[model samples]
Target: MQAKFLKSLMYEAQYKDYSPDFVMYDTLLEKNIPVVEFGSGTGRITLHLLEQGYRVFGIETDEDYQGFFLNKIKEKGFIDNFCYVTDITEVVEICNIIYPFNVLFHLNYQEVEVELNKLYKFRHCWSKLIIETDNIQYINSQSFRSKFNQNQDYFFKEFPRQSKSKIIIYNEVIEKNSLNIVLKFEYSLYLHKADDLNRIYNQIFPSAKLYGDFNLQFYRKNSPKLIAVCIK
Candidate 1:
């Protein structure tokens, strides 16, 4: 990505009410775990990880973006501590087959399964994991899902309408298999208010408690962005 495109990404973040420093570094301060970031676009979070003394590996599919990351790594003289590769499918083969480092993944909602499937074997190897992706709530909403194509001029986006409709249409399978909570966890960001979430959860898992507030560091408050973390 060119610096201009990167800046455009940042500007979008700014428009959402998120500050640069908050999303860039401070959020990871409490944990000094080594990081392997998937879909590491333009080194946004990778640079902050390096500055905090944590070893960082970035996985990117686009060759141009991978080169951008490499150039930044060279300029910063972090050749040893920070590295990036192009293909994530072969990540486990290249690194340890088991737990290598705490994983940090940032991708679209459609790729959540892909990322999870890739790291399923490696999950036990790490001490912690963080997944940064779209809010399930937003994707499920008619307005938000439509906004993707509308905002981008509907060029070539693959909206995961099946995933959204699956949970609703197959509620019997969901309740019988205890998949309701998982669905809520994934889509909690779509709730406009805390009460809205509370009501939805009560309707689904009545006894479930709201664990915490949304961490808006990686997103602007009003924007449709959401970052969910699952630590095992």
Candidate 2:
């Protein structure tokens, strides 16, 4: 009903056809060990795994997305396999953790260090940790005539602001038909190079592997997405 929520929904819809990030981990995510998805907004990856019969626990704190995620879990016609996990300690199982999409980008490089350190304590409980985020070096190299992009419902603009520590994105969502600005917000992202992230992950986990994209190619400059797999 709200413009921001509507814009967010439309943004997610655009990724519906992109299945590589959502499906690539299927075999690694064992059915016996629980699957934990951080930032499981609107039940995209959560529902996909559930449909495949893998029990999933979603960790999210946003109330708006939480409401939608809960409703979607009910729509799946069963609640036994999916969990809206409020506390990480609540899940007491050896698990495969998914920290996908914009989840990591929301934290700055220092914050990433802190978070990964916290996750490191759960090394025994987690079998693996997968993180997907934007490649700041690649994105910064591009020259865009417009910072704006759109989906079916609304047109939005992302202004990337860089400071000593983080790359923050300031967003503006406008009404579709009227073209009137409807919502404005901003969030921070870690835009450091692959080696920076790899080092941090390696310090926390035994092995850390990074890919440029979902195809699992070795990470290189200009790669659009940075995907990291840390093995316990």
Candidate 3:
């Protein structure tokens, strides 16, 4: 397979089937406020919302991921309901914002507070500011943090090197038949206390709430995920 096509293919296989966030996003949709999905990778949620008759403005810095989904949206005839830009600063409209999945892990609590303060003061619609991330505290508590998978066409592995405050995940994919390396991804995810995030966001939005998962349950120390929803 061609490199770009192969990467796109792998990306689809890795992410397409995960839909827990779908239910969460659906319940929060507002007709008049467009959803601006930060880190909207490959239109997973954007396309879903558009298909449900909601407008979406996707912000993604990765051009390859953006292009892959742009074509899909065009084919689905959802162009009128969606727009995309590479930078967050380029978004000018007020809308309900979502930092779905692990996108919030890219920033520490201080950084998140600073960014949310700026967003809340300027462009935030004040209806919602949804942020999601894995429970780094729980994840770090586990001894086995590595993962491996194999399929007919390719196999993938995740090797995480945890430090004091960040986890560096090294990922690689290999072709099955030829045993050749197909793609390698290295990423750093910052760790933050869920309570710290909740407190900081509460300062901005007095009604900020913390959930343990997509089901919107109260956060516990051992929960696998942390979801913070700030509503004014």
Q: What is the TM-score of each candidate against the true structure?
A: 0.47, 0.81, 0.84
Give me candidate 1's TM-score against the actual structure.
0.47
Per-residue lDDT of model 3, residues 1-232, tens digit only: 3355554556676777788888888876677777889888888888888878878888877777877887788888998888886645566766788888878777776777888877777644446778887766544345337877665587878788887778888888898888988788877777666667667767887777788877788888888778877776
Which candidate gets the maximum lDDT versus the true structure?
3
**Model 1 residue 51 CA deviation in Å:** 0.9
Q: Give lDDT tens digits, candidate 1, residues 62-169.
A: 554566667777889876987665444434432321111112222233343444555554545554444332333343356335212111211112222343324211
Put down candidate 2 lDDT per residue, 130-223, tens digits, no spaces. 8887766544544222376677778877777766666666778877899898777776666666667767867776567777777778877778
The candidate, 1 or 2, that scores higher on TM-score is: 2
The collision pairs in model 3 are: none
TM-score ranking of the models: 3, 2, 1
Off by over 4 Å in 1: 1-32, 85-111, 134-226
lDDT of 3 at 71: 77
Error of 1 at 91 (Å): 6.9
- In model 2, the runs with Cα more than 4 Å from the true position are 1-4, 134-153, 177-179, 210-212, 217-226
